[model samples]
Target: MKTAEGLKDIIKPENLVYRKSSLITDKPFSYCPGCGHGTTHRIIAEVIEEENLAENTIGVCPVGCSVLMYDFLDLDIQQAAHGRAPAVATAIKRLMPEKFVFTYQGDGDLAAIGTSETIHACNRGENILIVFINNGIYGMTGGQMAPTTLEGMKSSTSPYGRDVKMMGNPLKMTELVAMLPGTCYVTRQSVHTPAAVRKAKKAIKKAVGYQKKGMGTCFIEIVSNCPSGWKMTPVESNKWMEENMFAYYKPGDLKVPAESDADAENKNEQ
Candidate 1:
């Protein structure tokens, strides 16, 4: 009886503004400290939960940090070979068209090795969501340079900074895929700040909604920061990303159904 009336204002509604999504498991994330993969995982899980897709949502993960999504989200997920997530996702979605299928891939897995699978999926208009995390460097494999690595950027493989003359230019894979007619929506976002996180969540939810309507491939690129790989603090990595990555990638919708692209952009503003 001592605790019956002891918590009058201790647990008010105001004190519980934000709580963890139910879709996330109790298992701790394995990403490095300050890794964007954790935030991205939370956002995707939140969207799937909010959309009531928790049961039918299936994730096709690749051979990178992105594969950890299975441990975080409480959904049916399958792993794919290096750069073959799209192909796997295609099969999953085709076999169960009623289910929402998505592919979680990193820059190295999607842009470099799985480039063909990703392109063909977009070109063929696979009705699936593609969450592409671009941290520039390959975080899982000892911080090597990735296809989306910035020009003149340094990595374990590029000790003296990326030499564009020798290595060509950093690939703008998002824009390249957006150019395909099969793609329905393509947006680049980040999760560094609260506002950016909100935008990314909206982008994810929209992609899920579109897929439910049997829409074409929806690609959402998250331009993220890699503190460990970039050799900077989390805050510094975010600052550097805004200064360098955003300048080249430019966060926004790269493509949409021409008739509805303008409308979609306007809604995002509202």
Candidate 2:
């Protein structure tokens, strides 16, 4: 067996593969054991730290599971009324154009009551990042059905499973926003697996870069798992999300800037 000092030599900076972002507070996450909120928070913090935007970034969050986001992120965080995050984010960005502004919202808050605000924000082409977490149900305020809830999915309000005819089809908010002219980038991603996390992180970084360039609104929808709300093990929720949620809300970019615009931006940067 190696002594403690001998082990330290093997665990030098050269062997360091990963480290927690300083932007993330040391407080333990309040999310459920299998919830995806923790992973999403970590990546967002990492992105801000990696870009050296900790002091210049401001995040807006509304009611729902992410209501306590201010406790985890070490930055200027604004709390908006339930389902009003987009409006608040727009105001903040307009007031402080030099600062990086983003809204972190859940599906129920973003797609239901705040639907008009979200649509108008994108339509107006606000230069902000919208980080949307879609877990189908209201995770924090009981497992209630949300606008993005998959058809036939069970929730506290829809005990017998969602009825499409009665409750209407699940809304594809991401797809809806992608069609708006104000949005420059729109993508749907997940963080259920290691590879998925990598892709999601890249997507976030790209959105931040676009926001920095004032390229309209950049929206990223993270299809997350709500184990406690879904009444399943974390592993089971991931599997169900893959089989059901992915089928309806397919992943990948829904919108991107035209080639000419992208080329022009790239050249300008150079």
Candidate 3:
């Protein structure tokens, strides 16, 4: 009888102490088993919940695999045209200044077709956040070549490998965005490991916090894995990201509100 009681105690819901998952793991995610989008989505959802910004948060999802993010995130979400998420987010934040507005974009949407929109939005110092996923290829568009495709990486369009002389090097979106003075916060993070995941969550939280504080543009470029496009298993894709991608796109905060004397002086003058 004592053993039976103990077993019942172990299985009790109160004894289990179940905390609501910041992530909605029960919902069927559209992403493949090894896709990094699922991890990114979970982190974003957790950050929103942890910060208690669900009511005032608004998300703009681009026309890519990330477009389905609206369905997964239990927040007010708007769908943007291909590569126009930044523009959409800018308008939303401008009209509803009190609300927190963010745009989720993929490499193909942000780096290629939306290049002009992304640059102008950052240049204008829009009070919004951008979560950019750099997965090398256009996963939603049948794995076509993206501007961020590394030199010599093969894609549907680049069957013989990307030729640097013709294709140019992969676009480093984070570095480019960080160069703009209007961009207050910019970082490159990954979801390949637990440590990296923690760092990414921190970066995401900081980005949203900056927006909430009425700071200008905040951009987070996440180097994500796409097993289906990369032709590697989930484990192999994680390994590949750590080895090759991390070196090229080293993860860290590339830009933030200036603390240096020169920056202070510039801000003072402005």
Best model number under lDDT: 2
lDDT score, candidate 3, position 168: 91
List residue ranges in candidate 1 displaced over 4 A.
1-10, 13-15, 260-270
Tens digits of lDDT, candidate 1, 81-172: 99999999999999999999999999999999999999999999999999999999899988999878888999999999999999879999
* Per-residue lDDT over 60-80 for candidate 2, one digit per residue giving the tens place of the 0 to 100 score: 999998999999999999999
Clashes of 2: 0
- Assess candidate 2 and give its TM-score to the true structure: 0.95
What is candidate 2's CA lDDT for residue 268? 60
For residues 1-270, write the lDDT of model 3, one tens digit per residue: 999998987897778754544545456889977888988888888888888888999999988897888667788899999899999998899899999898999999999999999999999999999999999999986888889988888889999999989989988988998998889989899998889988898888877767877879999999998898988899998898888788888888898776763365345436
lDDT at position 9, candidate 1: 59
Instruction: Report each candidate's C-alpha RMSD, comma-separated, in the order given.
Output: 3.3, 2.2, 4.8
The number of the candidate with the highest TM-score is: 2
Each prediction's whole-model lDDT (CA) = 0.90, 0.93, 0.87
- Where does candidate 3 clash, by residue pair? none
TM-score: the better of candidates 1 and 2: 2
Give all TM-scores, in the order shown: 0.93, 0.95, 0.89
When summed lDDT is taken over every stretch of 10 residues in candidate 1, the lowest stretch is 257-266
